[model samples]
Target: MLDLTKLAQQMQGISQQLTLEATATRQRLDRAQLLMAQANERQADLVQMQELWRDRLNFTAAMPLESLDTRIEIAAPPAAHTVIATDGSQIAPSHHEIAYCYLINVGRIILHYGQSKLPLLDSLPEVFYRPEDLYVSRQWGIRTEEWMGYQRTALEAQILAELAQALTDEMEAPTLALTDGSLIYWFLEQLPAEARDRILAPILAAWDQLRAISVPLVGYISASRSGEALNFLRLQSCPYLAPDCMTHCSEVVDRAPCQVLDPLKDAALWAIRLEPGQRSPLWKSSARIQEFYGDHAIHFCYVNVGSEIARVEVPAWVAADEDMLQSALSLVLGQVQKGYGYPVALAEAHNQAVVRGGDRARFFALLEQQMIKAGLRNVGTSYKETRKRGSIA
Candidate 1:
């Protein structure tokens, strides 16, 4: 039972906070105006800043390092194009359950844009119970959800890449492989090196497989709030004189160069520039994951998807190849138009992968039945769970 009265009281505070933030954001944008105009003038100093703080700063590069103003016109999808997408859902391990287990379900959709054929849809659900699957490290403490979630996400990409590779190998026409987030495995950076490698090795292998197949794989982040580009703009605000990056920005907050645009996101910055189906200039990622990727470093562009500006991520190989880039853009925009401002294949994959409340109840019931048949005592749930369900008989 939700406490609507309490929730309503909380809403007032949220509304007030939003209003204050909005005002601050506008002021920040105003301060950023001069720097935005003088971006070209300040571009030369960014490298020196990077060189100086190469070890100190955690921010990504401030702006486009090369090809600052190249906007390619929107191209139409090929007459015979195939759009493939994959998404995932997961059930975290519950201590109250009879078995200490977790599940990951990946759903994929392959839709032919021009052909009059039915779309191929399938879901692969796996239950993990092995000791290795259930292992939790001292670093994670009691939180295994993050570990399992990362694995599920990585698996989703691997699965999508594998499917894309197999289909691309047989297809004659242009095929676009789409996934629902950044292609770079950014989350693994916080983990210990060995742990990160253990998880990322297979994902990297799958990326290699996709590259070998020569398919255009794109990651679509809808309503992206990524401020990677804006971080570059922040560099423009650094007042430290060129060749002397000695003084850090933190010490001179008021004297810092471009604070006005601090509140704006990359999406907000590009919203005014890009038209529907058009993509903004490509920019390289400065994430730590970039080092691991090397030649396959992640690069991104902003696309106006009619509804909102979406950030699309691709490996360097895809970005460097004009044909592949154009194909990815056209296919993604076409999918968005067909999906009424969202990609239909991704939506379908998500729908297929979702684990509903009813499904969870049934899963627990089945597990209990199996336990009983095995001559085990009934595994009762915790008092908290029982209270939440209000005496389920």
Candidate 2:
């Protein structure tokens, strides 16, 4: 067992160290602001720099669509609009489980405000026990876990598309469709070109549907650690007249002049400057994968949502159109206000998707019962798993 009592004396020192770090962080943000002010007029130079380094460098930097300080006023959300959201959970197939089975539960939520439409909330649970479901290529022993996350993302987006199409005649159109994380499909980048194409087909199709419907699909990331904005500031701070990180700063990674802002996140740049309900300028993502997005290219902006800074991403079409961007952001602000620092639809969806510990045990028990009913002799757990549940003193 671990005891906290032994470290009582060091607690104050830890607090003091944290305070010092906070002070240092504030100084770093101040430095970045100075760089932003100086770089505002050098937007052309910045863009040129990014294009020059496009394929050679593997860094995430924000590409501003306008002047660095440009911002849009968030209009009031429609008093009567619908918000739909999705979240997913999974029970991974395990060696210790009673069967080689896993579960995917997707939660869907739709809420209509300023209208009497009853909310639609449901969790769709799917069980995968078949050889086809358990493995992508069983001969190579590539289990589902190796690729389930991307599959779930595609599934969630596809469901959102279904919800949008299904509700068109039944109710007023959704003002926004939301999910709780990055929409970039960065996970697929790790796969081979052919594999990525096969896995990404569904997600792209879902995005195409949303694009056709023009219902702004948003990916809301609360307390984001992305350094796109910070990376931009880093480029501005690059000491070379013609900056080339490889040619100049490659040997001096730690001692580079731009490393001053390296410790800070992107949100810190807007935390103090942007008022609640205000947002940072839209910046197109530099991800290589977005090159393939075609109609669904990604752009993001940071919003000051009262309690915390949130990174909000939308498709290129929505981001470029002023009216759609305004509509989506205003509703996002409303959702944050209603939920108190988070989106209400997403919160409800998460509540539906989360699987409890008791649920896990009961799930396995049910699996065992069903296996016995089917006369399956292979439904057995390892001795180690049994010991984990009923440990000895």
Measured by TM-score, the strongest candidate is 2
Candidate 2 weakest ten by summed lDDT: 135-144
Model 2's number of clashes is: 0
Best by lDDT: 2
Query: lDDT tens digits, residues 1-393, model 2?
Result: 767797887899999999999999989888888988988979888888877885544467878887788766677798899898999998888887777778888899988898888898988888878876777534444457866666677778888888887776765644688999998877666677666776688888988888787888999999898888778777788777756767777787456777778778988888877888888888888887886788788899999999999999999989888888889999999999999889999999988988889878888888889889998886778898989889788
User: Alpha-carbon error at 248 in model 1, in Å?
Assistant: 3.0
TM-score against truth, every candidate: 0.89, 0.94
Model 1 global lDDT (CA atoms, 0 to 1): 0.78
Which pairs, if any, clash in model 1? 28-260, 29-260, 31-260, 32-260, 62-232, 237-257, 237-258
Model 2 has an lDDT value of: 0.83
RMSD of 1: 2.9
lDDT of 1 by residue, 1-393 (tens): 999988998998999999999888767666555555566565666756766666666456534745444466778887888888889998888786667888898998989867765688988888887877788544555256677888888788789887887675467778888999888777778878777776788777877887887887899999897888777766667554542333455575464444446557888767766777778878888887767775788889898888989999988889899888888889998889889989999999999889999978887788788888888885767777778789665
Candidate 1 lowest-lDDT run of ten: 240-249
Candidate 2 regions exceeding 4 Å error are 137-143, 171-174, 253-255
